[model samples]
Target: MRILLTSALAMTLAAMAWHAQAADPERGRSLAGQCRTCHGLNGIAKIPIAPHLAGENRIYIETQLKAFRSGKRQHEMMSVIAKDLSDEEISHLAAWYESIEITATMPE
Candidate 1:
C-alpha cells in the first residue's frame, strides 16, 4: 500500500510537470495578438524599435520570457510587457512564436 501510494504521488507530480512544459501554439497565437503591434507582420517588427520574434528557439523564448518576468532582463519595454504575463501565457506565446511558419527577413 505504501509503495502504491508513493508511486501514485510521483506520477501525479510528473504529469503536472509535463503539462507545465506543454506549450499550446493555438493559445500562443491568441496571446500574440498583443505583440503583433510591436513585433509586426510575420514576426518582423519592421520598426527599428522592436525585435523580431519569429523563428526563435522554444527554450530561448521561454528563458527570455522568464527573465523578463523575473526582472532579471531589464529592457526598455520587454520587462513592462512580461511583468504581467502569467507563466502559462508566456509559455503559450513562446510556443506560438517559435512554431511560426514565417521567418523575418533581415535587411542587408
Candidate 2:
C-alpha cells in the first residue's frame, strides 16, 4: 500500500543520515597526530603526567573533551587544544581511541 511504501522510504532516509554522521576512526587517527606529543599514536601517554587514552570509553572521552572545550574542566594544555575541536572531531577522536583493543593481565 502507499502508506507502507512511504514508511519504508522514511526509514531508509533516516538510516542513511545516521550512517553519514557516524564517527570515523581513520579520520580520528589522522587528527590524533596533534595529540601524539603527549599521547602516543596508539593513545598511550608518552609523558608521565598524561593519562593513557587507549581503550577508554567513547562517551567518556567525548565528555572530557567537551568539558575541556567548555572550560568546565581545567587543564592548561587540554583547554587550549580542545577549544578548537568541533563535535565531529571530538567524536572521531573518541572513536579512534575507543577502537583500540587492550588486554590486562595479573602478575603471577
Candidate 3:
C-alpha cells in the first residue's frame, strides 16, 4: 500500500514537471500574433468584444480554452480558433498571458 502511494505521488510529480516544461511563454508570444487582432500582444483586448487576458489565472485560461476546444463552450471565434490548438499550445498561451502584470488604481 505504501509503495503504491509513493508510486502515485511520484507519477503525479513527474506529470506536473512535464506539463511545466511543455509550456513556453516565448513560443506563446509568437503564437499570440494570431490572437493580436482580438487580444493584444500584451494580453489586453483590442476590441470590447474580447476580454482582457493579461494576468488571468493560468488554470482559468486552460479550463476555458479546453472547454472551447472540446465544444463545451461556444464562442463564434474562439471555438474555431481553439479547435486547432494542442494541449501544449494551450498551456503555452496560458503561461504567457498569466505572466503579464496589470494594475488598476482607484480614483483619489
Q: Between 1 and 3, whose lDDT is larger? A: 3
CA-lDDT, candidates in order:
0.83, 0.93, 0.92
C-alpha positional error of residue 50 in candidate 1 after TM-score superposition, expressed in Å: 2.0
lDDT of 2 at 94: 89
- Predicted structure 2: lDDT: 0.93
What is the alpha-carbon lDDT of model 3 when measured against the actual structure?
Answer: 0.92
Best-matching candidate per TM-score: 3
Tens digits of lDDT, candidate 3, 1-108: 999999999999999888877888888888888889999999999999999999998779999999999999999999999999999899999989998989999999
Tell me the TM-score of each prediction against the true structure: 0.71, 0.80, 0.84
Error of 3 at 63 (Å): 1.1
Please, what's the RMSD in Å of model 3? Answer: 2.0
| Model 1 spans with C-alpha error above 4 angstroms | 1-21, 103-108
Instruction: Estimate candidate 1's alpha-carbon lDDT, on a 0 to 1 scale.
Output: 0.83
- Which pairs in model 1 have colliding backbones? none
User: Model 1, 93: alpha-carbon shift in Å?
Assistant: 0.4
lDDT, model 2, position 105: 100
